[model samples]
Target: MKQLQKLKILDLQDNRIQGLIPNDLCHLQNLGSLALSENELFGQILTCLRNFTFLREIFLDSNKLTSIIPTNLFNLEDILYLNLSSNYLSDYLPPHIGRLKAVIQIDLSVNNFSSNIPSEVGGLQTLADLSLAHNRLQGPVPESFGNLISLQSLDLSYNNLSGVIPKCQKRERTPPQTELLPTLAHGRIAYQELLRATDGFSDSNLLGTRSFGSVYRGTFTDGTILAIKRLDIMTDLACALDYLHHGYSTPLVHCDLKPSNVLLDEDMVAHLCDFGIAKFLGEGESIAHPNTLATLGYIAPESPQERINMREALAALKKIRHQFTQAVKGEKHEDCIALRGESVGSSSEP
Candidate 1:
């Protein structure tokens, strides 16, 4: 590793590399990225990571790393993307988590992190995607998180977090240069392919219609099924309103959320599919019809009167899920009782 001093990008993903991450690799003073994901690497994250002063990215996900995070590792000043997901890493994050000044993406999901999220995490002013899902974290979403004005996609689901969400502090509003679809770098189908799958946008393939346009069920040559919502806003222009509204660097207002605007994938995962009237939270006023608003049924009523944070959203969804489960159970019980009654009557028939 020492001989590779000029190596800036080291990718060992999907390899069988086991054992501790090489401490000597830090000798590469100019190293900018390191990806050791999907490996069997184990042991503690060492303090030596701080020595890599110019390191900007690291992918240590899907490993067997354990123990509390070393606070010294957070001292890496130039690190940007840090993915420690799908590991057995335990303990609470240190307060310096907020000090990741240049870091943008932090994924600590599927770990055993316990205790409150440090309020200073709001200090990650440059953070875009912050995921702490499936941890053992408890307590409220930090009020300081409102200071993460540039935050976009956040995943704190499956934790024990409570309390009302702190209204995020508004920061400079910079629209993403790239739209949302481009963010799905994987499994992307071209416009021509979409057309071919939907038989030139024929009505036969139309699954539904929405405020923006129609949705067609498309099946590619690989037999992958996808629901495509044709929107009026961008066969020409483009944006990532679905990603933008849900977790774009800031909370965005999806002004036209409705049944028609929602697409269900083969997995039945509901995706926000329309963005003709979306607004970034920090963005002031409407440029279009001032009163143009969200669909009456689906749109969350104006804030204050009706507002919810991420935690609240999770709770609400859980409640709905519980209700559905209960209803299904009730139906199954009735069916069982009815079948038993029929069986007894037939047995007793003369």
Candidate 2:
């Protein structure tokens, strides 16, 4: 492969190619495009890829690649499109990412990357699309992001990010005007009007029912369609737990958290019920041993021996939710489900 020095393009995407990306390919210094996405390739990205100075596009998404993205990879100052999404990449997204001044689209979603997003990323003036969703990133969205004048799409969802979004100023170049949806003055719709739009919440309009509440597809007389969730039960539950765990000086743990213990109001708001086994952690204490036990399946694994705190329980619930989502999406998650079942079965054995 090193003999292919003059190769300008190398596209072997969507194949069953397995194993590490060969280093010899880096010898093609003049390569303008490289596409190796949707394969079974595993291992870290080639560090030598930085030597491909003429490379314009690199597609290495939907693979089993792992480890931190090489800082040198961002040295491709002339590269246009970069897709490294759906990998197992981890570690802080290097601050050097700002060096890709000419890149237009960048997708690094569905990875294990952690730490704060570098504010330097907003320096990519030519960036049009950016996605860093479904990662373990924490901290507020960078205020510098408001400077992305060419950004048409941005996604940072499913992260531990907090704080207010920076208001992006009007772009220098205005896009064509198009009416995508009906404009509302105050973004408020009357309850009676909503009822009428949803046909009094009829079964035919029902979209889906989650553990918290039901969603409906509502169509107005003006041919406007909207997906409306009747209740924010999960959000309410999370808020209640947050209050119990952090709002008060002494953190309180809801020892028994199960479907039956959650009560819903007429307005479809969820309330935590049955705090009979709730325990308050002492100063500097994290876990507590209670005389009463929570429902078997609802209890965390450490509940039997070393009891878990509210935060630990919440983390376990989040894991379960992620697994459930994978199952619903029909991904290859049977092994995870089977392992969970085995663990539950073992826990039940006296």
TM-scores of the models, in the order given: 0.49, 0.49
Candidate 1 yields a Cα-based lDDT of: 0.66
After superposition, candidate 2 runs with Cα above 4 Å error: 174-350
Model 2 TM-score? 0.49
- What shift in Å separates residue 49 of candidate 1 from its native position after superposition? 1.1
Pairs with steric clashes in candidate 1: 146-169, 151-249, 152-247, 152-248, 152-249, 153-247, 180-240, 255-294
Q: What tens digits encode model 2's per-residue C-alpha lDDT throughout 1-350?
A: 86889776788999999999987887888777799999999999999999886677899999999999999999988677899999999999999999998788999999999999999998988789999999999999999998898888989999999997677654664333333333443566777777988899885565445454566667887776676786655555654564455434555678777789787755565667666676766667767645443442233333244456957655554444445445545774452343234331111100
Measured on C-alpha atoms, candidate 2 has an lDDT of 0.73
State candidate 1's TM-score: 0.49
lDDT of 1 by residue, 1-350 (tens): 88899776688999998899878876876666778999999998867778776577789899999987889888875577899999999988899887787687999999999999999998887788999999999999998889887788889999999997777776755544433233234546678888888999885565444334456767677655566887544211112232233222344555654558765434343445444465445444334333333432333323333456755543333333333334344744232223123321111100
